[model samples]
Target: MAENIVQRLRDEIENGIVTNQFAPGDRLDEMQLAKHFGVSRTPIREALMQLGAIGLIEMRPRRGAVVVEPGPHRIYEMFEVMAELEGMAGSLAARRHTDTDRTGLLAAHARCEHSANADDADTYYYDNELFHHAIYTASHSSFLIEQCTALHRRLRPYRRLQLRVRNRMKTSFSEHGGIVEAILSGEAELARTLLRQHIAVQGDRFSDLVATLSQREAHSG
Candidate 1:
């Protein structure tokens, strides 16, 4: 029951952060969260710690917990590293994936397609995560999978923000198709390049994120 409460609280807080209900720099009061969720402060504390681990929140002595949304430069740097990590995963996946891995990738992509068709960014974000994890698993390296998954979770809110941009979901779905084709064709270089481009925050996408973050900061201020 305690584990259940922790998960529930964690999900609620994550959803709140991703949806910008809990904006950057907004302090999270444990007592208020506990009261709002009808739970004890124990679970609320656990949830905040988990969020902190994933880079969504910062827990400071005396200051409590607050949102830690990255600024434009920091976000770009993170995305640059993310692109390289994903590129490595895609390259290995193209070279080492089994037919079973291909099947799993296709299945994950189908879910993403379903979510995109429905115009549900939240659901698409969930399925989009699955799609990327499928790629990492197909890389056939336990360490690589663990690393990629960790970074992916850490960047969840920003990635979720990207999907909220106009028609970004559709574009993302199409990019996924290119990546899948490259992987299935066993074109390692192509797969790596495509995945890098697919994940990188560049051009108009970076601008979109900048505008979004600026607006969020203004609202929070």
Candidate 2:
């Protein structure tokens, strides 16, 4: 029962089923969710506790537990951090990855190409992530992979949203090709610079994308 309830909660949170219905900083009604899950408050409590530990939601005194949003500035801050981490991964991957690692990355790149050509942005999003993850793992550094993946997960929602930017998927796919070429040539410095810019550059489109998303939500609401 406990495990089932925890997994259910995890799925709901990860799929944005709850967040879509509730705003950031809003308290979660434990009784409501417990009822929805057809379970006692015990597992619900356990789930909330676990989420709090992960920095997803915060448990408060009287107001109850609320989801935390990183707000505006936090988005740029995360990108800055991601740029450095990804640059390091690219640098190491260029020099250290096995031939098989290069093969896996090329496969992921092919998937991205197919998805982009199809205008299947959702599929591209998934493949793009896999491609980046392949590079990170290619570094053969467990500690680096773990840290990079954690940060990537935290930034997942933002990255997911950016996939909707006009023609961004195709542009991203092209950039991925460049990175792959650099890595294939063992150009560590070139790979690092390209990877960092690839992750960090919104290129005059950041505000437009932000505006579009904001307007979209307002309209949908």
| lDDT of every model, 2 decimals | 0.87, 0.79
Best by lDDT: 1
Q: Model 1, 1-221: lDDT tens per residue?
A: 88978977887898788656888989999999989988889999999998999888998778899998666677677788889999999999999999999999999999999999999998998899999999999999999888898888777767876788888999999999999999999999999999999988433486676677668878887
Sum up the clashes in candidate 2: 0
**How does residue 189 of candidate 1 score in lDDT?**
98
Please give the range of 10 consecutive residues that has the lowest summed lDDT in model 2.
13-22
Least accurate 10 contiguous residues by lDDT in model 1:
201-210
- Candidate 2 structure quality by residue, lDDT tens digits, 129-218: 999999998888899999899888776656756777788888899999999999888999999999999888742345566677577778
Task: Flag regions of model 1 displaced more than 4 Å.
Answer: 1-26, 37-43, 202-207, 213-221
TM-score each candidate.
0.85, 0.77
Error of 2 at 14 (Å): 6.1
TM-score of 1: 0.85
Task: Spell out the clash pairs found in candidate 2.
Answer: none
Clash pairs detected, candidate 1 = none
